[model samples]
Target: MKRAQHFIGVAVAAAAVIGVTSLVGNDYYLRIIFMMCVYYLCAAGMNVLVGFAGQKSLGQAGLFAAGAYAVALLTTKTEISPWLALIAAAAISGVCGVLIALPSLRVKGPYLAMVTLAFGIVVEKLVGEWTEVFGGAQGIYGIRPITWNDQPLTSQQWVWFAVVLCALAHLLLRNLLQGRFGRALLSLQADEIASASVGVRVYRAKVIAFVVAAVTCGIAGALVAQQNQYINSDFITFHLSIFILLLVLFGGAGSMYGPLIGAVILTAVDAALARWPSAQHFLYGFLLLFALYVMPGGVAGVFRALFKERTETEAGEKSEEPPKTTRIGPAGEGELLAVEGVTKAYGGVKPAQNVSFRLQRGHIHALIGPNGAGKSTMINMLTGVVKPTSGSIRFLGQEIAGKPAHLICSMGMGRTFQNLRLFSDLSVLDNVMLGRHTRMRNGFFSSLMGLPVAGRQEAVTRGRALELLELVGLAHLAHQPAGSLPYGLQRRAELARALATEPQLLLLDEPAAGLNPHETAELGQQLLRIGRCGVSILMVEHHMDLVMSVSDHVIVLDYGIKIAEGKPAEVQCNPRVIEAYLGVDDEDDIEARETCPPSEGRRDAET
Candidate 1:
C-alpha cells in the first residue's frame, strides 16, 4: 500500500515536471531547470550518507570531478561511446568512494570532515597539475554531445533527458531508502550503540552508503558533462561540495523530496541574481540564513511535523484500552545460561574475576553487589558487548563469550540497558521493529523487487512487532516517539523491544531503578509474568523488594567475585549476602530473623 502511494506521488510529480517544461520553453529557463535537476540528484546522493547513514563526507566534489573527467577523457581521447563512458564514470567514482570511505571509517565527526575536505582539494589540485589528460586548468572542451541512432539531440531534448534521469534517480533513491539498507542507515543515524547491539554492521553500512552516494553523484556528473559538451576543474570545486551540503540540509536530510525542493529554490534564486552581481553573494547568504532560522527542520520537516500532529489528533479520538498484562508460562527447569571461569580486567583493575554461575531457564536470576561489584560488567560479557579475558559463556549449550552483540542476540539472547539505549527519535513501533530486524531474512534487492517472500516476511514482522508492543502494554503508544514517553513507559517499551526478538533468555539491567513504589510493584508483576512465558531472565537490580518478589534464584557478587548463590529464600539469610548488603552483621538480629516464621522471616530479612 505504501509502495503504491509513493509511486502515485512520483507519477504526479513527473507530470508536473513535464507541464512546467513544456510551458516554459525559454533556453535560459530550460537550462535552469536542467541544472536544478542535476543539483537535486547530487544533493540526494549526499543525503543517503549524511542524512540516513550518519556519516559526514565533504569529498563529493572529488567523486563528481572524477566522474566528469572520466567521461571527458574517455570520449575525447579513447573514442569510447559517450553512453559507455557514463557507465565507466559511475563505476570509477564508486571505487573512489570505497577508497575514501575505507580510511574515513576509522575517523568520525570533525576529523572525518577534515579528511574529506582534504580529499576534495587534492582531487582539484591533481586535475590542475595533470594537464596532459585534463587539458590543464582550462579543462577539456568540445566534448562530443550524446547522440542516439545517429541523430543529433537538441538542447531541449538534452534537458528532458537530464530531467528524466533525475526523476529516475529520485525514484530509485526513494525505493532504496524504504528498503532494508535504508532502514539500517536510519537505525545507525538514530543510535549507533543500539544499532550495533541489534547486529547492524556499522562500518559496512557506512561504506555502502558512501559508495551509493558516490554512484548517484557520478551519474549526475555524467549528465552535466553530456549537457555542457565541455568540462573544467572550476565546475567541480570545493565550493560546489559546500553548496550540495547546504542543499541537503535545506531540503531536510532524510526526506526524499527535500533535495528537489532545495535545489529548485536555490537554483532559481541563483539564476535570478545573476544580473545583480554586486548583491548576489550577500543576498544568497541572507536567504540561506533566513531559511536556516525559520525552517530548521527544512521543508520536509515542516510537512512531517504537520503530518505527525494530524496523526496524533486522529489517534486521540480512539477508545482507550487498559494495559495488557503479559501471560508468561511456567519457568523452564534446565540451565539457560552458564558462565565458567569468566574473568575481565581493565588496566590491572579486575572488574570481573573468575565469575561462574548457571542460570535456570524461565527464572528471574538477580546479580547484585555494590557499585564496583562487576555486576554490569558480567552482564556485558554475557551479552557479547564485551569480551572476557578468560572464560566461556554458553547460552542453551552454545558458546557465545566473544561474539558480536548482534550474533548473541540472533542466538536468542536479548538485553536492556541500565542507561536506556532505546532509539529515542523513532516511534514506539519502529523501536520494536528494530528488534525484529534479525528475523527479517529478506535482502535489499528482495525488498526493492517486492518479491512475494519479502512481502510476507515484512507483514509478519510488522504484525509480530505490534503484538510485542501489545504484550508490554505499549500498543497505545505505538506512534509516540520513544523519547517523548514518560521514563517508566520508556523502560517498559525497551523491555517490549527486547522481547520482540523472541529471545529464550532475556537480560534486563535495572528495569525499575527510577520508578515509584507503585510502578516498581507493577514491574515486579510484569517480570513474573514474563518468566511464566518461558523466557529465562537474568536481572541486575538494586530494588531488593522487586528482586526478591520476582527472582526464583539470586547470585551475590562482591568486588568482581561471586559471594554466594542459591534460591531467593536461601541466599537472603546467608552471612556473606548480609555482609555484601549491610557491610556489618548483627548476630542477635540474624538469630532473631532465623527464628521467625518463614514468611515473616523473609520479610524481616529483606528489610
Candidate 2:
C-alpha cells in the first residue's frame, strides 16, 4: 500500500510539473516555479541537518550566500565557466559548513543556534565590507546568463531543468533518509547516549548532516543566482535564513515533501500579497499565525493525519501477542566484561572509586546501590559516555576504557539509560531500525542509488527490528509514535532498540524503575530470559525484589565503595550491608534483641 501511494504521488507530481510548465509560459509563473525549486533544495538540505540529524543550524543563508558569491565571482570576474563555478560554489560552501559545524558541535540547544546565527552575520558583514571582491552594498551586476552550447536558454527551459534537478535531489534525499546513514542520524537525534552505545559515531553523523545540508544549499544558491542574473549579498541575508527555517517548520521538518509544500505555499502567498502593498505584511503575518496554530506539524503532518485515518479507525482489530523477552542459552565459560579498579570523580566528588567487577558469559549481574552510590557513573564509564579517572575496562579481552561511546558499542557492548530516551517524534519501528546502523555496511552512494546490497541489508535490518520489538512486546506499536506510548511500554521499546544492535553484552540501567509490581515481576523474567540467549547482562536497578530474583550475582555499593558481594540472600544478611541501610547499632540490636517491654512496665509508665 505504501509503495503504491509513493508511485501515485510521484506520478501526480510529474504530471503537475509538466502540465503547469506547458500551460503557464508567462514570466511571472515561471519565476515562481524557479523560486519554489530553489527553496525546495535549500529546505531539503536544512531538513537533513535539523530534521534527520537533529542539529539546529540558523546559518543556512550564510552558506547559500557563500555559494552564490563564489559562483558569481568565479564566472564573471575569473572567466570560469558557469558550470564549473557552480561546482566550485558547492565545494566551497561544503568546506565552510564543515568548519562551522566543527565549532558548533561543541555546543548544543540555544548555544549552537546562537553560534550559527553569528556565523551568518559574520558572512553578511564580510560580503558587505569587502568592496573589491564582493561589490560591497551595490553587489555584483551584469552576471552572464547560463546557456546550452551557444544558444541562451529561455526562462521556461530553466524552470524545467530546475524542476528535474530538484526532483532528482528530492528522490535521492528520500532514499538517503531510508538508508543506514539516515538511521544513524535519527538514532543520534533520538538518543545520543543510546546511539553511541549501539556503535553510532555521534560527532561524525552530525558533521555529515551539516555538510550535506550545506552542499544542497550551495546548489540552490547557484541556481538562484542564475535565475536572477544579478547576484548580491542581500540575496542571502539573515532574513532569508529565518525564512528557510520557517519553511522547514511550517512544512513539517522530517517529511520529505515538507520543504517543497512549505516553499510553494509561503512563496505563492508572499508573492500574491506583494501586490496589495499596504496590507501585505499584515496578511502574511496573519496567515503564518493561522498556520502555526492550526497546523503545528505543518502541511506534511496534515497529510499524514489524513492517510492514517483508516488505520486509526481499525486499530482495535490488530492482533495480540505475548511480550517477547531476551533469552540466551548457556555458553562455554568466557568473560564478557571485566572492569578493573574503575574510578570516576566529578570535581571533588567521587562517584565511582576503585569499582572492580567481572561479568561472565550468559550471566545476569546486578549492580545495586542507593541513590548517588555511583552505580550509574560506573555504567557511564563502561559505555564511554564518561571517562574513568583511573582503571581499565576490557570487553572480550580488548581494553576499551577510554574509547568513545560509539566505538565501545561497535565492539559489542550495548547499554540503556536510567531515563527513557526513545526518539519521541520517530515511529517505534524507526527507533529500532536505528539500532541496526552499526551492522549496516552500505555507504551514502549505495543508499541514494538503492543498490541491491543496500536494499537487502535494509530489509534484513527492518525484519530484525520488528523481531526485537516483538521480543520487547512493542510489535503492536511499531507504527505508533514512540513518544505516545505509555511509560512502561516506552521503557520496553528502549530495550528493544538496544537489542537491535545485536550486542554481545547488554547494559540495562534501571530497566525496572517505573514499572508496577506485576510489571517488575515480568521484567525480572525477561532479564533471565535474556541471559539464556547468550547475551551477558549487567543491570543497574533499584528494585530490590526484581534484582534479587533475577540476578545471578549481586554486587552492592555504598557511597562509591563496594561493601558486599555474594548471592542475593547472602548479601542481604551482610553486616556491612545492614550497617549501610539500618546503622551498626541497629544491626547489633536486631541480632541481640527479640521482644519489647513487658505489660507491667507499660502499666507503670501509664500511671
Candidate 3:
C-alpha cells in the first residue's frame, strides 16, 4: 500500500514536470526550465547529505566546479562522448568527495562546515590561478554541446535531456532513501554510538552519503557544461553552493520533491529579481532568512501541513492487531563470551577493576549494582565501546578487546543503551533494520540499483526485523517513529532491535528500567524466550524482581568490584552483597527487614 502511494506520488510529480515543460511556449521560458532542472539536480544531491544523512556540507560548489571542469576538459582535450564525460565527472567528483569526507567528517558541527567552506575556496582558487589548464578564470570555452542523432541538440532536445536526467536522479535517490543504505545513513545521523552498536560503520555511511551528494552535484555541473557549450571558473562560486543548499532546505531536505520545489521556486524568484540586479543577492539572502524562519521544514513541509498529510514516518500507520514476539532458535548455543581480569580506569579513578565473568550460551546472566558501581562501564567494555585498561576479552573464541564497536557487533554481540538510544526521525521498522546492518549483503550500488539479489536480501531482512518486532509486541507499531512510542514500548523496540542482530550473546543495559509490573513480567518472558533460542543474555538492571525472575546467574558489583557471583537466590542471600549492595543489616526486624526496608532504622535500633 505504501509502495503504491510512493509510485503514485512520483507519477504525479513527473507528470507535473512534463506538463509544465510542454506548456513553455518560448525559448526564454525553455531556458528557464532548463536552468531550473540544472539547479534541481544540484539541490537533490545536497538533499542526500543534508536531508537524509544529516551531513552539513557547504562545499558543493567545489564539487560542481570539479564536475564542470572534468566535462569541459574531457570534451575539449579528447573525442570522448558527452555522456561518457558526465560519467567521468561523476567519478572525479566522487574521488574529491572521499578526500573531503575523510578529513571533514572527523570533526562535526561548525568545524565540519568550515572544512567544506575552505574546500570550496580552495577549488575556486585552483581553477583561477592554475592558468595553464583552467584557462585562468576565463575558463574553457566552446565545449562540445550534447549532440543528438549526430547533430547539435535542439532546444527541445536539451529540455528533454534535462527532464530525463532529473527524472533518473530522482528515481535513484528515491529508491536509495527508502532502502537499507538510506536507513543506515539515517541511523548514523540519529546516534553514532547506537549506530555502531547496531553494526553500522559510522565513517563508511558518512563517506557514502558524501560521495553520492557530490556525484549528484557533479552530474548537474556536466549538464550546465553541455547546455552552455562553455565553462568558466567564475561559474562555480561559494555563493552558488549556498544557493543550492538554501534551495534544498527551503523545499524540504529529506523529501523527494524538496529539491525540485526549491529549484523551481528559487529559479522563478531569481528571474523575478533580475531587473533589480544590484539588489538581487540581498533579496535572495532576505528570502532565505524568511523561509528559514517561517517555513523551517521547507515548501514540501508546508504542502504537507496544508493537505494534512504530513508524514511522521512511512512505517507508522494504524494497525489492527497488537504486535507479536518471536521465539529464538537453538542455533546460538555454547560459551559465547569470556572476560578475564578486565579493568577500565580513568585518571587513576577505577570504574571497573578486574571484572571477570564468562557467559555460557543460552543463559541469562544479570549484572546488578547501585549507581556508580560501574555496571554500565562494564557493559561498554564488553561491547568495545570502551577499551579495558587491562585484561583479555574473548567472544566466541576471538580476542575482542579494543575492537571497534561495529566490528564487535559483527561478531554477533548486540546491546541496548541504559539510556534509550533510538533514531527518532526514522520509523520503528527502520530502527530494527539498523540492527540488521551487519547481516545485509548488498552494497550501496546494489541497493541503489534495486538488483534482484538486493531485493531478495532486503525481503529477508525486513521479514526478520518484522518477526523480531512481533516478539516484542511492536509489530503493530512497526511503522511508527521509534521516539514516538511510549517509554515501555521504546524499551521493547530497543530489545527487538538488539535481537535483530541475531546475536549469540545479547547485553541489555536496564531493559526493564521504565516498564510497569505487567510489562516487566512480559519482558522477562521475552528474555526467557530469547534464552531458550540458545542466545546468551547479560543484562545490568535495577529491577530485582525482573533480574531475579529472568536471570539464571547473578553477579553483584560494589564500587567497581565483584562482591558475589552465584544463583539468583544465593546472590540474594549473600551477606556481603546485602551489606555492600542491598544495604541490608542482618539484625533488622522481620516486618521491616523481611521484604527489605530502611537501613537507617536498623542501624538506629542497634546503636
The TM-score leader among the candidates is: 1
Which candidate's lDDT is highest?
Answer: 3
Poorly placed runs, candidate 1 (over 4 Å): 142-144, 275-294, 306-308, 311-333, 449-453, 585-607
Cα error, candidate 1, residue 201 (Å): 2.1
Q: Which candidate model has the greater lDDT, 1 or 3? A: 3
Per-candidate clashes come to 4, 10, 9
**Per-residue lDDT of model 3, residues 239-303, tens digit only:** 89789889988899788888999999999988877788667788768767877898888999888
lDDT of 1 by residue, 364-415 (tens): 7888776778988998898888889999898889999898888888888888
Residue-level lDDT tens digits of model 2 in 441-546:
8877888876788888999889888888777666777888888777878888888888877778889999988788877887887677677666788889877777
lDDT of each: 0.79, 0.79, 0.83
Model 1: how large is the Cα RMSD against the reference?
A: 3.2
Give me the displacement of residue 441 in model 1, in angstroms: 1.7
Q: Any runs in candidate 3 off by more than 4 Å, and if so which?
A: 1-25, 308-325, 582-607
Return the lDDT, model 2, position 573.
Answer: 60
Where is model 2 poorest over a 10-residue stretch in terms of lDDT? 598-607
Number of clashes found in candidate 2: 10
TM-score of 2: 0.90
